[model samples]
Target: MMPCYSGYTKSGDKFFICGKLGPHCADARCMDVGTILCDYPVGDGKTCDMPICESHAFEAAPNVHYCPGHALMWRKFVDAGGVERDLKNVVPFAAKERT
Candidate 1:
């Protein structure tokens, strides 16, 4: 009538639970194995936003992430005189984009 645990380790009198047991991508739609951190922080400010596989990881700005499709879209946006807004407060594109 006792439950069994696989990742639990007992050292002396203390027990520790192993973190992640397997590899998983941060993007819910992705099926590829994760290999890199997106480098963008989530709202919690403690963990990276996306754990992407090599194929999905787009190097937009050195260490930043934008995905392959998004990278191209971002380039077009910048080319049209659009600037990246602050993460804390996002404004309308019409107001932020330069003519």
Candidate 2:
């Protein structure tokens, strides 16, 4: 079984966390394939907005949202005026686009 982090959403939703799969890594490339749930619902109260995992979570700076891969890249993006909050709403950019 894949490793995961369990937690509650702001609205009190439970979920199992996994890496955000897509092309936003160190090399502007991503290797995660198939369907991996970056933010998966568990108890189904509302929906957890945080996507966190021990093996995949990376803190770009302090208090910044956890990134799946390429933490530095993400930090740079945020520093360059990117929206930090958006990371939680739309990770694995491709996945968000699909849905």
Candidate 3:
């Protein structure tokens, strides 16, 4: 299963939004402030929404990032010579139209 994060501040006031100092990294081991969200598409037109720090994020493409686990999966897919169209089918937003 994919890792995810969702919670509020200690005061139970501020909600966690990855990238800000308020939220922590989704990776349990790291304590660094999250810098971005995993771009991996989940379902129902929603993304993984996994909070990831700079060190834990892997750029699959420009402005497209994946969490450590997803990154490894992506790497394996690429290594196996996966098709780009297949990836687009999974994450349409990550691909842009060409002129």
Best by TM-score: 3
Q: Which segments of model 1 are wrong by more than 4 Å?
A: 1-22, 27-29, 41-48, 67-79, 83-99
Query: How would you encode candidate 2's per-residue C-alpha lDDT over 1-99 as one tens digit per residue?
Result: 543334445586765556544322221233223222233222655322333433355644454344444455666777876775666588464544565
Model 1 clashing residue pairs (backbone): none
Q: In angstroms, how far off is 7's CA in candidate 3?
A: 20
Ranking by TM-score: 3, 1, 2
Clashing pairs in 3: none
Model 2: runs farther than 4 Å from truth? 1-48, 69-99
Model 1 agreement with the true structure over 1-99: per-residue lDDT tens digits: 322213212342433233453454555665545557666444667535456665567777766775545556767877776764534377557755678
Model 2 worst lDDT run, 10 consecutive residues: 23-32
1 or 3, greater by TM-score? 3
What is the overall TM-score of model 1 with all chains considered together?
Answer: 0.38
Model 3, runs deviating above 4 Å = 1-20, 84-99
**Could you tell which candidate, 2 or 3, scores higher by TM-score?**
3
Which 10 consecutive residues of model 3 have the lowest summed lDDT?
Answer: 13-22
Provide the overall lDDT of each model, using Cα atoms, as 2-decimal numbers: 0.54, 0.44, 0.75
Evaluation by lDDT, superior candidate among 1 and 3:
3
